[model samples]
Target: MTEALSLVPTTDARVARAIDLIWREADLLDRREYRAWDELYADDALYVIPIDRETDDFASVLNMVYDDTRMRRMRINRLTEGYAIAAVDAARTVRTVSRFVPLAVSDDEVTVRSAQILVAYKRDHHDLWAADVEHVVRLGADGDRIVRKVIRLVDSEAAVPAAGFLL
Candidate 1:
C-alpha cells in the first residue's frame, strides 16, 4: 500500500498540517488523554467504524461503532470516570500512520486518507490491527477540528479482540 501511494507527495504545507493533526490525535489516544483527545473534534463530528468493509452507508447498514458528538462525550466520560471497566484496564497502544494522501482540500475543510497499524500491548499479550483511516477536518478560526473519522478495519468480518480504547 505504501508503495502504491508513493505517487502522492507529502511536501504540501496543508498535507503536513493534516498529518500533524492526525499524529497528535493518535498520541493523545495512546496516552489515554481522553479529555485532550475529545477536544480535537468539532461539535458535529462523527466517528464511525463500519461492520462491513465494503460499505460506509451507516444509515442503511449496521456499523460496528457510530458516534456523534453526544455519544463521543459519553464514551469519553465513561473512559475517564472509570465507569468503563474495559477501558480502565485497556492495553496501551502505539499507532503508526502512513500513506497520507489528500483526498480533498478547501479553504475550510481538508479530507485525508491514510493507512494505520495499531499495536496494543497488555500484560504478556499484544494485538496488531490494521485499517484504512479517513479523516475530514474542518478548519476554523480557532484551529483544525475533526469533522468526521471513518476507520475500515482490515479484518472486519473476523472475530477480533476487544477494542476498549479509541481506534
Candidate 2:
C-alpha cells in the first residue's frame, strides 16, 4: 500500500499567505472560473508547461507553453471562445489539491510545490479519466501588489489526455 504524504513547512507569514492564495487559485480552476483565474496573474507573469521527456535536460526539450500575460489572455480567449471541445467537457472535471509546500521563500517572492489529482467525468463517449500532477508556482512582486506566477506540471507527457484546459 502507498503511504500518506505531508505538506511543506513554512514559518514565514508571506509563505502562509501565499499558500492560501495558491489554494484559492486551485479552487478557482477546479470551479472552472477562468475569468478569476486570469485575474490572479501578474502582468509580466509566466505560465509554463515544460514537455516531459525521459531525459532531464529541460532546456533542450520543448515546453508545451511558456505564456506571458498576453499569451495567457489568449489562452483564456480560446477557451471561452466556445470553439474548443475540451472546454465543452471541462465543467465536468474536478481536481483535488494536497501536500502543498513552500519550497523557497523570499522577501519579494515565494515558490510553492503541491500535489494534485484530477478526476474527470465526461458524457457517454468517454470513461472517467484521472491523473496525478505536481505544480511548481513562482510568485513575484508587481509594485505594491504581488504578481507573477509560473507553474510547471510534472506528469507523463504521453499519459495526459486533453489537458486542453490549463491545469
Candidate 3:
C-alpha cells in the first residue's frame, strides 16, 4: 500500500530523526543486540504484530504478537538467556525498512508509516517477510522512545514459515 505523505516530508527534521531511530532499531535486531533494542521503547510501550490488516483495535483483535513492556522483556529474556531464537530455527537475517511516510509530526511526537522487507536464511532455505509498519515515537529530554509499533504482515492469513528472529 502506497501512502501519500499527509505532511510535508522534509519540512520538519523530526521526521528524519524518527527514521534514524528506526534504522538503528533494524540494525540492533539484525545484530541480536537485545539489550540495546529493549532500551528504545518507553515503559508503557506496545509492540504488536496484528493478524487483522485493517484494524486499529489491536487489543481486542487476534494478533500474532501483542506485547506490553513485561511481555517484551520476557521475550527478550527468552531470546537472550536461552536459545529461543538461537536454536534449531536460527536464521541469519537482513531487513530493510523504507518507503517512509510521516503521518504526524509534533515537537514531542512523530508518527511514521513505512514498509519493511526481511529475508532470513536458515538451513539452506530462504524465507521472506514483508510488512507495513507503523511507529509512534515519543520525544523526551533523555531520548526518543517508541510508544507503539504495529507490524501488519503482508500475508497475514497465509501459513508463514516459523521464524526464530524478531520481526
Per lDDT, the best of the predicted structures is: 3
lDDT by residue (1-167, candidate 1, tens digit) is 12223444567666677778999999998899989999999998999988788876786888888999999999899888887779889998999999888887666777889999999998889899899999988877889899999999999878889777889
| Per-prediction TM-score | 0.91, 0.72, 0.92
Q: What is the C-alpha RMSD of each candidate to the true structure, in Å?
A: 3.9, 6.2, 3.4
For this target, which candidate reaches the highest TM-score against the unseen true structure?
3
The reply for model 1, stretches above 4 Å from the true place, is: 1-8
Better of 1 and 3 by lDDT: 3
lDDT tens readout by residue for model 3, 1-167: 32346645844678888888899999999888988999999999999998889998988988889999999999888877765646335788899999998987887888899999999898788899999999998888899999999999999878888666788
Which stretch of 10 consecutive residues in model 1 shows the poorest summed lDDT? 1-10
User: Which residue pairs overlap in candidate 3's backbone?
Assistant: none
Count residue pairs with overlapping backbones in model 2.
0
TM-score of model 2 vs. true structure: 0.72
User: What is candidate 1's local distance difference test score?
Assistant: 0.85
Query: Any runs in candidate 3 off by more than 4 Å, and if so which?
Result: 1-5, 83-89
lDDT of 2 by residue, 71-117 (tens): 88888888788888877656365666666666655556666556666
**All candidates' lDDT scores?**
0.85, 0.59, 0.87
C-alpha root-mean-square deviation, candidate 3 = 3.4
